[model samples]
Target chain A: MPGNPAVPVAGNRFCIVGGASLVGSATAGELLDHGAAEVVLFDNFAFGSDAAIAHLKDHPRLRLVRGDVMRMANLLRATEGMAGVLQLAAYMTLSMDRDPWGGLDVNIRGVQNALEACRANKVQKVVFASSNAVYGYGPGVSGDLVEGTPFHSVGAPPAAILYGASKIIGEQLCRDAFRKWGQDYVILRYSTVYGERQHYRAANALYIIETYDAVRRGEAPKVFGDGSETKHFVYVGDLARANRMAFESQATDVAVNTSGPAPITTLELVRLVTELAGGGPEPIFVGNEPGKVRLTSGGAFRIAHEEAFRAIGWTPEVDMKEGLRRLIAWRESNEGRAAA
Target chain B: MPGNPAVPVAGNRFCIVGGASLVGSATAGELLDHGAAEVVLFDNFAFGSDAAIAHLKDHPRLRLVRGDVMRMANLLRATEGMAGVLQLAAYMTLSMDRDPWGGLDVNIRGVQNALEACRANKVQKVVFASSNAVYGYGPGVSGDLVEGTPFHSVGAPPAAILYGASKIIGEQLCRDAFRKWGQDYVILRYSTVYGERQHYRAANALYIIETYDAVRRGEAPKVFGDGSETKHFVYVGDLARANRMAFESQATDVAVNTSGPAPITTLELVRLVTELAGGGPEPIFVGNEPGKVRLTSGGAFRIAHEEAFRAIGWTPEVDMKEGLRRLIAWRESNEGRAAA
Candidate 1:
């Protein structure tokens, strides 16, 4: 084991696995801003798009590598001289419902591949991007969700359960790697992430974009199930800081929740998005759409990030209103329009 | 979709994935005894042993096909014309701890491959061998463990959590196949299985065998903790019956527990094993063995099988005492001795 688990950012090289992503891009920028020698963005563009990282394309200290997490050679080469690695490559519930085969492959095997590569490359520390989905869905998922909360899957969609269980397996893989080899690592169980570069792939986070789009097109935003379902989402920028803090902290072999400042119900979120989208029509209440994979909680719940503050000296700084405002502003911007 | 999901065992063909092991061999025998025209035992023998299936090697109705679940071609060829496929291929906590890469491949990808092969072959029904591990291990795992119980993994070992989460994914994969292709399937969430042909692979079940071996050599059986941790185990013969019923019944798209009549604490189990082995020295109480993987459940719990009876009209017939007696008899027999 190293004398200290912390891997200082200054003058150190960092590799972001699945780097061409909302969180990945933001973390790369954060690392580069902190005086990192080089920030390598490795992604295969499977779900990633060039537009997501277009702003960082010209940075002298930033480099993009076209790579796939399923391919170990790419990861091995990417992390050869890196001091830290942030694994953000995974498939959310929406895509998992469409293609479970690929989702399981990328989510489970992908993490193992990245960890093995980091071990072989002697990467100083790894910051794995886990999800609060580890707590799971349905009736059993209510109340304050701490890091020790059990996974609840009763009444949940198979795809949603698969996605959650896959994340659980990924986190365990990191823990297993640490036990076998003295690998210093921290797992940030990020809640739904929504921000400037947010994609329409995550089941929970997609609701914000959809509500905004409906309001933008002069239609009432739709809220399912009386809009009482709780959703907690972290801004991409806050998560980016969490990733950087994980690398700089002495915490190792630990996992904690990294959620937004607070959770909002569907009705509240729809109302907030409609107001932010230039005072649109009243929100419409609706039942679940058949054939749609939706994640629902039985009761109101909050994913507490107190453990995160203790683990990496970090906490979510962006509130939903501010985060949503930034997201809407980005949607109207040229870069976001081009990406859409 | 079939008008009726039931697939009669009489005069029909069946394939058992991972069929050279304990549950596989026993289920194959049960199917053959029920007048099935042919029974195919497909396995790679990586964990499966020839001794486990030695008794049925000469049976004209039983055909052993050497195959690996990781290979789709092997599964496709083995599952051809099969009315039902029993997917038993998996790596338990011990093996998963040793090699997580191989374990994840066999547990997750292996289940997907079997389901896909069943789809391609137009198989009538599938009986997936899921485990009670889906409920997970930890302090939160107490009381009656029914089908709807959520998974608890807060304080468990990484390998244990990995094994449980893998089973959860496997069960969801079966559910996904059913929804996508109208595949008829029944999931049997078996607790620890022990019986005549018991193997030394399962973490919980190995305790019984280990205790017996120690007692036989005049050594005191070792009990970790106060020996009050609950362990619920189903007899292999009873599980075989459940597998056969799952195929013969009309139940599909449902998962239920198949456990013994009741649960027994660790100390009670050790005492029973010692008595079953013709009385031995008192068990020695000790702390956890260093460098060893141990699955510790927090509170007393019983895995309920009422749902299994409701779903498949099956319940465990042999209690642990009777089951242990049969296992002891087999161990002293010529066949069991040679196999060991």
Candidate 2:
């Protein structure tokens, strides 16, 4: 992390709003790994995990504050004495689509609570985990959905999803927070992230992990849409590193593309998962249905990881194949077996 | 009002989520005027007026639900029998800027409550009163802010005001609600609206009325800015009509502008008010300060009026001059002697 020394060091007090979740926990763990003196887990536990808390319970520096993001007083208590915050608390993917009202409450109101806390605490810098979903399935590469892409929430000529709408709102919240408070924030619009501890039980990720498990069981991995639809999946560890990089960087108004180098089609992913799992199952292709196609993808999730790389000297350490291998192996291990 | 009769009429039981303020009360009044079978007013009365409630207290088909938009249960109860909803409850310009914490709670959380209420109540259509402030002052025709202008919140580059930030969040909530529930919504981004029954004591309109009174008392109306910067002031009456048009037309996935023909610079406005008041004070020009240049002239409002005109054959009956005249006359006849 050879960057401006002005960046707050990890040993300094830090807060993770909604820190009991996979992304927030990962970010907190990364901070602890990099020598943070204090890592406060500020979470309402709404979609949060007790296992995550139990995992970090032994860590002397990590403290968990059971709190809701809709309540400012709770967030304030959680964020007190923290120098910086990593805001990863949001309703994403199928969660919002299935229940938009809940999504609005968690995503929009939750973010607002964190922002208000940030303002009250005068926390120095915040790294907001936005999503590439803000850019709905629109045209081509356009330099890998850079920070300045005109967000067309209305996907193409026809269909759009609630997930995209929620993510767009999330980005706007970040922008507004930054604007109103001059609070330094790093917005990382992550591509689809998959790794151990990922909330695989969620509808969208259920498919991903279910596919992996089925392949392990020598069954065909079920894909809803045609295999041609592509996605950019970055390992969760790499995303965790990106969070650390953002905290250690001084770039203002920074929004980096946190994605893998290559965009792989769903078919390719299925085959790769099978190969990584050591010859378990064949890849199965479902027909091109509207709902499935809309969910899978019509546009590629290619992002230029250069901004993040250059700013934080962060790079993807694990390629998809190796990452998938580790994921499968972990899934077969004790904890993995329990989760399965 | 003539358009496609195929467009469905708003459901019989209509509710205005914040139907006690300027926009909400005005919208409710218009809905009643346009033949809504039943109109329910759901407001917490944080900024609402007892006088406004008293005016509508005796209406045959009107009902009042005294509740806050932040309280989901309250909103749920209020929305129980409503078919369509006009969500107009929000912490407005002055309140948001002064009390940012309260602003986030009321604006963002309140919106979430309304969204949940609408979804739970199975409301047919939700007409949301968004603001043009979502687009901060950009380089264009002062009144040329369009629906598609990249809405970089003023907080982005030049710094967004808390009011602007709140409205941006409100707009996102509306978008999310529409996407999540497949709820039909019409987002009307109104410009500065001035008309009858506007809380003249409210911070925003109070300043305007105070200035008018000062000028009428032969005192110079002080200009905060250079007076060259302009704002598109739409009459509240016109805005009310626009809301009616939105309900009557049944337009979906649309955010139309509701502004007057063009903009009147502060200097020009002061001059007009002087003339209208009959031998009143001259205008005083303050230097170009940071706060003074705050005005948006995006054309979205003009386009919205045109769209409304096309959809409902609606036109703004009162021009700016006439509207100002009406406001001054009303003020003089009723409150002038007492206040003076």
| Tens digits of lDDT, candidate 1, B94-133 | 9999988899999999999999999999999999999999
What is the C-alpha lDDT profile of model 2 across B163-216, one tens digit per residue? Answer: 554565566666666655577777788777776665753343565676787886
Worst 10 residues of 2 chain B by lDDT: B1-10
Error of 2 at A327 (Å): 3.6
The DockQ values of the predictions, listed in order, are 0.94, 0.13
- lDDT, candidate 1, at A177: 87
What is the CAPRI rating of model 2's predicted complex?
A: incorrect
> Positional deviation of A294 in candidate 2, in angstroms?
4.8
Lowest-sum lDDT 10-residue window in model 2 chain A: A152-161
- Model 2, A74-189: lDDT tens digits are 88888887777888877765555455556666776677678778788877777788877655554433345665554443233222334554455555566657666677778888
For candidate 2, give the lDDT of residue B121.
Answer: 78
